[model samples]
Target: MKVVKIGGSVFKKENIINLAEFIVKNYEPYKTIIVVSALGRSPYPYSTDELINLFVEFKQNHSNGNNYLLDLSKSFVVSCGENIAAGLLSFAINYLNPEFKAIPLNAFQANIITTDNPIDSDIITIEIDNILRLLENKFTPVICGFQGVSKSGKLTILKRGGTDITAAFITKLMKANEIHIIKDVDGLKSAPPNIIPHCITIEKCNIDELAEATMNGNPVVNPEAINILQETNAKIIIKSIFSEKFTLSSKEIVPTQLVSNISNKDNITKFVIYLPSQMKNKTLVLDKVLKEIFENSISLDFINLDVFNNLASFIVNNNQVEKIKQILDNNQLHYKTMGRLSKVSIIGYNMRGKPGIMYRINKALLNEKISIIQAQDSHISISLLVPLKYLATTIKALHQEFFEDY
Candidate 1:
């Protein structure tokens, strides 16, 4: 059996029928399961974001504090995108290739059981009985992606880009022979191609390496889904929707390059807290600040500490800028902010014990007239914080030094 996941970008009028043809022609031999995402960008009535606009307008006049009714309603509407796609694809397949039957299955019929969270859900279990029965009957099951039902029978939705999770879960539990994720791009690249045109396609990589390398911002694979598949033997094959070439995920991966990929997170707000030199117990005070941030549930990244200078700093998404200020002000902690910042990161396991990588990074940025604001590293990754204006130049410079030769 083969499980193929079609991305939302391939759902436009220009290509959908072609996609159906490709699926039918390429996957006709296998007992297949097709998972579908919401239609592409908005203005189209059935697109996921447009569906959410329905709830957003309703919530404006009938505002209620966070509650199940509001969340449940939003989940139902957004989940409709996948539902529509599933039905449409099933119909398309049946029309295009009459000999091969394609059946659409909703969350209940597909038995996608998830936790009680309505807006952002996690899959708890998948009963293969129904999907298996369909395959045995010479039918292909087109299951709605990014949605499941809670034990209480409430409609629930997964995080955005979660269709990847749905495909992996089905393939793993169903013990299917292959999992193919269809995207419009040419496999995975070291960086966003638009930003760094010279970026090379990554032919193969370990799941952990990909996740660490992408920690700056890319999220090439759904993190939770990657975690679920990390222990399994299944290989995730990412291919362009209409092409045969692909990037494969492997388990026993060895480092292939000094640096495998580079990615950047833009519009980051960095907060730096410096303790008074005369203040006693500086370590204790720094600990308190960190504890408060954690208790308040403010997620941060790229943390740096200078014990001798009694300074600590970290970056958070721009959306949380206000929350950070509130926490700092209420706690009476003095701090400074670097707004409109970006963090460029290089990720690779082969970098450990290697010399000149950091020197090369600094030289590259210096030559491009890009100043590094702050820097941090782990065994496999190096994150350099710089002004947002210099982001493009930083990525290009680093890519040239590390990947152009590679």
Candidate 2:
């Protein structure tokens, strides 16, 4: 059996018939399951983004102010996209060829159980019996991606862009041969093509390489999908529905680049939480400050909690720095901001257990006279916090150092 996940990029009324034709032509004789994302970003009524906007407009107009109800209704409202996509694709497939018994299935009907979180929920369990029955009856079961039902029957959507995880889970649970992730782009690239004029499309890479390239704030594939299939052996093929050119993601074939990809984002701001030595329970105060930050919906990254030094720091989107400042000032907390920062990131499986990777990164930036304000590294990636003015030069330097041949 094969699991094909059609992303929102190509899951639309304009392309549904063509995709249906392709599905019927290729997998007519096999027990195939399809996971579909909402329609691509358009003015279309049922795209998840549009539906989310609709929900926002409703909230703004009505002023319901009920967090629980708004959350529940928002999830229910957004999930309608996948529901429509599944049904439309299933019908198109059947309409294209009568022999293909394509049947649309919702999360609840397909027995996909998830947590109660309306906006971002985890899949708890999935019973394959219903899907098995449908396939045994020679029906092509098309499931709405990115959503499942809680035990209480509340419709729960996974994290934003979670349709990929839905497909990965299906591939693992059904023990399918492989996963075909159909997207608009041909395949993964060494760098954002627009940024790096000479970048090349990566032909094939290990799952880790693919994850690194995709996870660095790129919207190619949901990182959660890679995490779900960590133990899975299924070959992952990412291809554009419009062309046969693809990137084969396996466990063994790591990327050839020492640093596989360069990722950067603009308008990031650094924040520091100062814990005064005289303050009793400095740790507790830090915790309270962090709690208030989260409560105010201030998301952050690159958190450096220096308990010994009685200080804590992190980065947040620049737009949120004002709000963060207000929260800190209102709580009478001591903090400071390093605004107008940018993040430059690089990742490679080759860097695993290898020394001097940081030296190379530092040397590259140092040669270019770019000051790295702060830096962090894990087994797979190295991230740098640099001034926004040096962002372009930093990327050029890193690319020249790490990917000069390209």
Candidate 3:
């Protein structure tokens, strides 16, 4: 069985029909299970600030339209999940050229249980077991992507791009042949194209490399879903939904050798605040300070408190240092010391298991007078911490070393 995940960005009505046609015309020989996401039905969900504003708007004007709008936001999430399944099913039989029979799968009665709060959820097993039985019967199952019904009988939405989790879960439960995720983009890129215009596409990526790339902030598949795929040994492929054709079975989809020089540099600003760790109502003071910082749109980088040593340290955006200093001075806050920091992460698949990569990188940074505060390596990337002032020099040196030719 081939399990396919269609992303929300490609979830338009016309696109859904085209995808169905492509699948039937190309890959129908293999039994396929499809997973769909909610991003298709609405604009991306609100961010932390936007959600707060949405709530505030509701409070200011308590009207039926506002209430309906809020409820619709919730409903759109559920609908996106359901319609992806329903839309695919409807298109597969009625619209596609060489149409195949599609069996619409609903979580309502099936044990597909989830949590009430859409933010965090836990699934029940009995429900999963029942769903697996249907797939085992040679029936094509269309499952919703983001929303789930919890054990407590509450509706819950998965994290952003969470359809990947649904796909991985189904693969483990049904033991499908492989999972294919089709999105608008052809495949994962070395970096976000917007930031790095010269970024190249990756032909093949390993699970560990994929996860590390995501953790360092490029959106591919969610890192959590990658873990599940690794655990179950499920073969996975990510491709474009807008493609003209699809392969008939897992064997037809091949993995190729592909690598590209990539660089992603985080723009950093930092501020440091140091204070005695102990004082009466210290916790309350810190809370108020953090609230003010956040309210001013100043994001924190890292914070450490040493009670025994009677010291506290806060690191934030470098550009916000002046403002933060003014706030502290106005409040008559005294501190022992403060400083700024910056970080740069290098991401690539071929970077692992090699000696001296870190050594060479560090030496280059030192040659440029960029002092390293801390450094760490992962399967796909190296994260280096340094003074904010030298962030440009650090990125330029590293890029020259690894990507100058490209």
Candidate 3: where are CA atoms >4 Å away? Answer: 39-60, 63-85, 97-99, 122-126, 136-138, 242-343, 348-350, 359-374, 385-400, 403-406
**Relative to the unseen true structure, what is the Cα RMSD of model 3?**
7.2
Model 2: CA > 4 A from native: 25-30, 63-72, 277-300, 307-310, 318-332, 366-369
Q: Per-residue CA lDDT of candidate 2, range 278-354, in tens?
A: 77877777778789888987777899999788788999887888888887787777888888898888877788888
**lDDT of each candidate versus the true structure:** 0.82, 0.83, 0.60
Q: Regarding lDDT, does 1 or 2 come out ahead?
A: 2
Residue 138 miss distance in model 1 (angstroms): 2.9
Give the Å error, residue 276, model 1.
3.2
lDDT of 2 at 44: 79
Pairs in clash, predicted candidate 2:
none
Using alpha carbons, what is the TM-score of model 3? 0.67
TM-score of each: 0.92, 0.87, 0.67
* Model 2 TM-score relative to the real fold: 0.87
Give the per-residue lDDT of model 1 (tens digit) for 218-321: 65666666676775777777788666667777676775777777877888999999777888888887778779889887888978788788788899999989
